[model samples]
Target: MAKNGKKMETQRSVDQEVKAICDIMRRGNCAGAMQYVPELTWILFLRILDEMEEQERQAAEAVGAAFAPSIEAPYRWSDWAAPGSEFRTELFEKGQGNVFAFVNGPAYGEDNKTSLLPYLKNLEKRPNATAKQKVISEVISGVDRVRIDTERNFLDVLDKVDAITSAAIDDTHVFTLSQVYEGLLLKMGEKGNDGGQFFTPREVIRAIVRVIDPSVGETIYDPGCGTGGFLAQAFEYMTGPKNEKIKSADDLSVLKRDTFWGREKDNVVYPIALANLILHGIDKPNLWHGNTLTDQVGYGGLFEGAPPQFDVILSNPPFGGKEGKDAQSKFDYKTGATQVLFLQHVIANLKKKGRCGIVLDEGLLFRTNEDAFVKTKRKLLDDCNVWCIVSLPGGVFTSAGAGVKTNLVFFTKGERTKRIWYYDLTDIKVLKKTPLVSKHFDEFFKLLPKKEESELSWFVDLDERRKKAAAEASPFKKEAERHARAAAQWNEKLKELKKAKPKKAPAIEKAEAKQKAEAKAARLAAGKAKEIEDAVYDLKAVNPNRKPEVDTRTPEDLLDLIEAKGREIAKVLFALRQ
Candidate 1:
């Protein structure tokens, strides 16, 4: 498919070309990557979409089938942005007699033809508009007008973007245009950017996808698809060289048009995610643009058709995200922690025997102080076989501006977690340049199967630990119940006393309140007893088999070292004074 039988490659990697585009935006009003990327996302999306529609039209024509595009004649990329494009040539006449006038259009003239933005924004209202049309409407729903601030600068951006195409990619590399877009996303998530929450490191996405190993037939979903990374990676894994299961058109069809689904509430992120997956070659991204945990709606048209449950789920929900009471009202275990609520949502949305690999905050793994956190972890263990937990190195998310210690939990529905195999990578320090790479997880992938134990890995028999805790708590629960029964008896006695002698009622009521307080105390004791097991659920991969790093020196030696360091500092001060 290379033009002229010479493989066309971009001037550089896709990232470089995207940078070139952003650089042009920078010359105009778009000052930062955050500002330019969103404006660029829709532009790039429309460009790819037009090419894809052109291909569809060609295919339809080849077979002599009736052909209709999602975006018709004058609005298509070739019709508006290409050199010598008819509508573009007439922009002075069509766009209210000025090119910039069409940016936020009232392109209605004597001819009554709509300009680009108005046409795109009006697609959904057309009679029996397709899903793609509705999606097109929402992707640009947030863009009131062009942000680039001038006609010449915006045209330059289009010219640079127009060069990116399937035909322009190097044939030698197993490539997708999505790789280029990913680089733009990385810039958006770089150390200082405001888009950190939406970005997960690329290596993290790849590792989770490799472990989950989603296949062609299975439906993959991400409840919080930040830029659709999980869904995009899963698509790559299923269709990549490793996966040979895709033998027929139907299999690829299922993967492309029917398999991927997700939900995101942020308006900026929601559209970006849809574009990301589409670039990854997923035809129908099936993404819902709304809060996953709440009833509030943004645009649910694409998501409304997603199956209630999916066969595979992969995601890293936003860490330390906060939700209000309205978001918490839907789940049984109420919590303001976004990660905790997303965990419940993930568990609730998995199909029987379904598999999931999710990134969770390390604090969520270990903290037993929050009742919601503990209950959710317990519910996870009760409902799924959490076969593996990988303790990620510190700064795994530093590149994304998240310095939080994190963990990867792999689980399957339809079974309970008996034991959890843990692989520790905490000792590997990650810096901005030197990040958590695939080689860091080489040992992990090697030891993951058979649940092997090493200095870096170990397993915990959760079933045994819980059994021990339950046995210890059994007597406590029984004693608590006895106290509760006695409290009830006191309540009845107080009632009887009140009926017999009204004057005695206050004193009896005081005694009854004391009994009830004891009962409450006893119940708390029983919960604390059971909580011992839940505390262990803080499954940090602190490998017990590994030798401890002990301070070898005794007190005299330690004191000598401290004095020596103090003397050295004083010596430096003395030299300075002299």
Candidate 2:
């Protein structure tokens, strides 16, 4: 009990320290949460990396294995960050030759090294560099020198960051930092930074991950990996109790080192993605910093090697943004829309049988007017089994700086879609203040694989759908005429039966009643069968070319009319028996 209490106290301390650091950065006028979050991310990253390296070193020594540090001694977090420490007190404060000038001055870090930035950039080309070293260099190369004007503020931020101890790497405490970082990213997204292109809401991210169900060893990639939310959640899902595919340390090492990959175009957002993954316990995430929409020049030119293929993909690519001619030229079905290009990129890069869950605007589903849009859907259906589309309520993403109605599309490569299941949550009233929660998707998840018909859930078989589209000249006209004649004949029969006299004998009346009951059951069954057949015809009238007034009644309402006529026809049959 005492040990448990101690752990709780430590966790609280780390959480409060992070909150305090964010408060200090905000008070120091570091340009609000948006600017300071990135600054904070770097400091926190370096500190966290230092702590993790120390842990690794200690573990290696316990096992009698030689360990080489990723960062050289002079540039490690402990070397320069602490006050009155070795570099500050022994080497720099006493006017040691070229010490201060070399550490912070803006110049090419040559001979012995000039500044932090230069050394970090130079690590990219270092011979036999580890993946960890490359990640650190990539993060630092994008960051400008500390923008905080006051030395006191900078040092204070460092002190608070250092308080987040090595214990934070524990699964329980580490997720606290991930949550804090996500909140800051949410603020950036809310402010419409980078047109809110990379920010997918955390709730939406979880739903996609849960549905995609990535296995432990399977590779997961996100092309437009904004802050690495999908990758992080995939990690969480595989490591959670429900995962059985991961059974050994080597399997875990595979997850940490190579299971996840991503690409991001925005340089400002790239560091945040790296930090996010690191916080989630991914030791070395294979994230390429480039525009995924643009085609790679050649082998090892843009992408590290040939295009990376993945077993599962989860992404919410930017919607409605227009790409340039250069980007559009890369896709076979050329379009200026950014999502269209991403769709093409995802389809092309997925391995055979790769499963993907993507968030897209509603326009992609029903846009049949344009050639590019039509062809894109055509290719999607022909090349993949698009099993489900869950339409989210409107304003579900207003908090994330997007107000467009969106749908989550789940598909697997290598199988042409035979039927598509759709669930509509549009009427559920999701707002910026009261946005969508997991409960909003409960019904969707329940009805998804079953493809059951509910008020909001329906299925569309592509083969029958194609035939109806082809018959739009007069699709429902013949069915409408046949049903009208049936109704008229039933009405006449009922009138004739009501006009006839009833039998006077009690025995005859009882026999007639039994006959009527049997006839009623048969008529009711036939009516239901007809209703099922007419539902498809009713859908045909919904085609854009067909007039709505041609079949104003829905299939359900028409079924009610048929059942009413069936009862009257049963009464007429009883009169004939008498």
Candidate 3:
């Protein structure tokens, strides 16, 4: 039934239910999306966990195997939160019990048991606790009490959230709880929001996942797993119904328990990531809560037995992040820029013949001025087969509040890059209303099989171009070396003459002149050599097949239009003043 005394459809009612929960949170103390999302995340996580555990318990009982529940009674959703449960019944019937006092206070009832928050927070301290218990403790670590101010508003949110499940959604709609949570994440990442920095557009993640095509038994990782988007999408792609890959029982076990790994540094986003992966049906998401660059460990109980390297890596690390010297000292190609350092880290964390798809800014591709950036790129070219580079539109990240131009880089380890195929989408106009979608890359994947060349796609033979540059730079480099050696000999001779003569003389003056001339010649040769050396390392994608479009507007027409627009603006301003 609808609030307006009419019936609504399945998907529409489900959406309304989720929105109504957010409306209640907005009216409560949890005002902002950043605040309300985290509060909602914990409750949503607990609701789904209880349902999943109940299903597991039934399966265990059918198999005649003993099973220990992750969460016990009175604290579980069925004990206190489910509709018509003991706690809910007592709370509403003659004020026999208080839901708020039961959840967030010292011993309040006749049983005199601990509160829900304190009980969850102390689960990790128990001897021989299950992994699920440890995860619950981490997710509920900072939540000392409920965020909703009033008990009435809190119970309203719980009731609305309880109505949202697979039973409420129609089979024709193909909706899931993960999709509902994805909507909340999208709201967190909209324009003018601070949480936008921790999000990547889902369409972009889908494109990268399809191109990578992760397998069932392979391991996937994300170093900066903001809300675990990449890992969860990979899980979806691997287990999707349309996939033709065969899944054995062993493969299914590995996929459920040991296939995903990630690390997140943020305090709030880390717990949300754990809940997100668990919501996506990943039983053991081996995530470390800390900084990957600095190796600062916050919590590693989940990631305790992780291996050295992974088979496939997909990530969109934080853009425009700047680290300090503490993180810079850990890498050989040291740089304060976050993306460059993460690029190096990715290259090091791959197994032999492993594949990777990463999102990088355009600046890192063309930057030769910084030694760290150039050297890291040079390592990438030497260590991996960088097969394809796609230039995404400048506004692809506009909804996430990032207006920088980005590119998708695909590569495989254990081979050197000889050629690079580039697909250009810069000509396509992207806006906040119209964004870059999965369909935009259909042609890119179509042309990727043969590395075909077209108006929007081209390839560069990296080996041949680099050989030509080296051949051209050889003579100047030799000349520079020869001049440097001569300059050193002349300086030595001048020093000997000064020591022997014990006074200034013509020989000393003559030696000084020869030394100065040799140094000047060396400087000239070195300058020319450096110019060619930098050009060889320049890997910016510039399509040779496409010609620059020329503008036909003459100077007179442009000036006249500018003057007319200025006069119109002045008239509007004059009217406002009058």
Model 3 quality (TM-score): 0.91
**On residues 1-578, what C-alpha lDDT tens digit does candidate 2 reach at each position?**
11233432444554566667877887777766567878887877888888789899999999999999988767788887755568645544545344434445565224655576667666767887677877887777667577665556777777667656545335453445566567667767773554366688888899899988888778899988988999998897898743465798898898998788888877778878988899878888788787777754211111354345889989898888988988988889888888878988899889989999999887776665455776777788889998888777778778766788788889999998888777777778876677678888888778766778777777778778665544652424444445545555555555555556773455445544555554555456455444433333221111222223466799999999999999999999999999
Q: What is the lDDT of residue 56 in candidate 1?
A: 89
Ranked by lDDT, the better of candidates 1 and 2 is: 1
By lDDT: ranked, best first: 3, 1, 2
Which regions of candidate 3 are displaced past 4 Å?
Answer: 1-12, 91-97, 106-112, 241-246, 505-517, 520-524, 550-578
Per-model TM-score on C-alpha atoms: 0.88, 0.75, 0.91
lDDT for residue 9 in candidate 2, whole number 0-100? 43
Model 1 score (lDDT): 0.83
Clashing residue pairs found in predicted model 3? none
Among the numbered candidates, top TM-score falls to 3
* All candidates: CA RMSD (Å): 3.9, 19.6, 3.3
Which numbered prediction scores highest in lDDT against the true structure? 3
Per-candidate local distance difference test = 0.83, 0.72, 0.85
Q: Which stretches in model 2 have alpha-carbon errors above 4 Å?
A: 1-16, 88-103, 107-112, 166-174, 191-195, 241-245, 296-308, 473-578
Ranking by TM-score: 3, 1, 2
